[model samples]
Target: MPRKRYAEDLSVEELRLLLIEKQRARRQKRLEHFRRSGRLVVVDDHPTQPPLETLASRPLSEETPPATANPKHTRLDRLLLAIEILAVLGLAFVLLNGFTLIRDLNREVVAMINQPTLTPTPAITAIVLPGGHTPPNSPGGPRPNDAEIPEHLRPVMLSLPELPTPTPSVEQAIRIQIPAIKVDAPVVQGDGWEQLKKGVGQRLGTPNPGQRGNIVLSAHNDIFGEIFRDLDKLKPGDQVILYSNQRAYVYIVQQTQIVEPTRVEVMAPTQEPIVTLISCYPYMVDNQRIVVTARLQE
Candidate 1:
């Protein structure tokens, strides 16, 4: 028997030719099987031509096995795929909205922390009290009764410069009439001693006549026409008519009290339209102050 040739003994050219022959044989076998299964069809114009030879003449790309038919996608499969896509999109949208909300809240908190704080300043402060006077017809004449002022605050009163007197206007209190006390007096701008000498003095910084807040009017009980001599006699509901250049505003007396000279709170501002009348107490011995509070008549 003849011995078979080993692959190791073959030349390079011969090995290459051997691989080509084996590939052709495998392709031919696959093409024949496909033809029998009706996956491949051949038509020849010349009846005498061999089908194998014709197939071998075609390109290698054409000799590939027929592809299997793709599986059909059902409605349920399509629906599931669409649902997966929508769920992904919805999750993305929620994440975006959550991030946006968090960012806005952070901005608001930062703004609140950076905002400025406001402090309220009181409209009235503790200074010298009003309605101080000497004895009626004293030998040296009438003067400020400085003995009543607290010793600690005496320097402040002496050092305090007189505020500029406001110009007379129609909006300011020009006259005051209290029929219950049989008193009618002229009203001036300031409550200083010189201003009080002219007539009843309206305290500076108080509200105007008929307007909101406290309207402080002061006068001496024994001197300067003794404008508020009988202020204590006014009863509740007694009318106190205050006149301006434009018109007159009537206020009803509410109450009266005798307070210490340092009890300056009686001159403080009020929320509603009101008036506070201040005068020295008693007939001639002027020491404590008598305060009469009245509310504007509706």
Candidate 2:
């Protein structure tokens, strides 16, 4: 081999950059070898390599090779990514019943980790009033159980004019928005139910406004392997808006909860109208179900 050029061969700044380039080239060759050997890798070739300091230090949370990412020649990154993908996919396959199980679970679990956790606050709890505080003539009188509407006991309530005929309008698909990532995915209802696994689905039931229940919708985080790649970037406060019949129903994200595939109670009816968005964790397959619930903004 020819003698290697020393740092003295160039200016100080040039030397630092040249060193990075050398390291990068060495990285590329190794990556090429892996590719030839049929190993999955992160592929990124660049003129300017990251600083040695950067390669040496990092925040622990960002250790993975990235979603659907090609090899960047880092042993740690590649190893971590392989581990994660394997773990997520294996669990999903064991629990869910399909090939896309891993992808689904990855999307859900990863999204959960990426989402903002909302803890109920004592201050908010204090705002709620105890029953029986209202005056006798007040509109909201004391009531033991809310299920008994006072109007049911009055003759005048029966005389109320027949409810206006419901306008016959075609049902429409809902829209989802992710401000932080600039993502706009049309959420088809029920697709989150049984029809889609490692696939997208549209809701089957007509969306009932003010129903005080879960209106579930779902989609594939990724398939044919293109990554949202940023599906993992959905943070708390993300807006999942639904537009139908020329009206936009807004849902403010509350919290992201991860439940085992068998935990069906989380999808149970709520006391207030809310929208539930479900998808596989990480992206692309239904390994685990991620349930994102948002109450309609009053």
Candidate 3:
């Protein structure tokens, strides 16, 4: 046998030539076997080698060892992934809170819309027609005309407590001037007993001056300045001037009537703008009512 040559002792050029010759021999042997078996042979440019030996023999730059992850880089990637997950979870929480807030607001608005509205109803001020009074220049001071009230209702009317008068407003009837009757007097808010004692008292539920409803005003014919003493003298076409804070409203007298005290229908609301003046009829005798109806001048 020839002397054995170690791989380490061989020159670089000689080793390269030896590796090429070995590869050529292996390819020729494989080709001969395939030819004998009548099979097609595919040759590889780089022949297979032991995996560990191939990797050890290659230069460090060429090997690339599957690019094992760096410890610092792996930890940084894990941290970034955790931060992204937290960001998604935080966005979801904010969206859920916003949705809950909107749903609550909608419920509150619906509840408010479905709530019932309350309308103010005027209080009942008197039991019977207003302006009832005792005869003028009587022995006792002017008292409620119990004779005018029905016998069965007198006790109830007498027992009724006085109500507080409402504060005067600019829209209410403040004064009245009747040219035919030569009457000029201040107008107050309520037609209750105490209210009529001051001056002319407007019925509680009547409309204000010049409005499209009955404006009922009352005063004692025999007492309380006897403001409506000459109401009967007023004739149709006569002017009844009513004043508010803003301006004066002239109402033309339509008619006058003497009705039983129980005829409260005269004070009922009217479709047109009208004013109703009321007082006890027949001067000193206070059993019936004298109503003067007037329409607002156009």
Q: Each candidate's root-mean-square deviation in Å? A: 15.5, 39.6, 15.0
TM-score-superior candidate, 1 or 2: 1
- Candidate 2, residues 178-228, lDDT tens digits: the string is 566565655433442233432334344425544566675654444312213
Candidate 2 TM-score, C-alpha based: 0.36
TM-score of each model, paired residue for residue: 0.60, 0.36, 0.54
Cα error, residue 117 of model 1, in Å, equals: 13
For model 3, residues 187-282, the per-residue Cα lDDT tens digits are: 888887888889998877688888998999999887778888888888899999999998999999999998888877777767899999999888
Evaluation by TM-score, superior candidate among 1 and 3: 1
- Taking the tens digit of each residue's C-alpha lDDT, what string does model 1 give over 198-272? 889998888898899999999888887888999989899999999999999999999999888888878877789
Pairwise lDDT winner, candidates 2 and 3: 3
lDDT score, residue 57, model 3? 63
Counted clashes in each candidate structure: 0, 32, 0
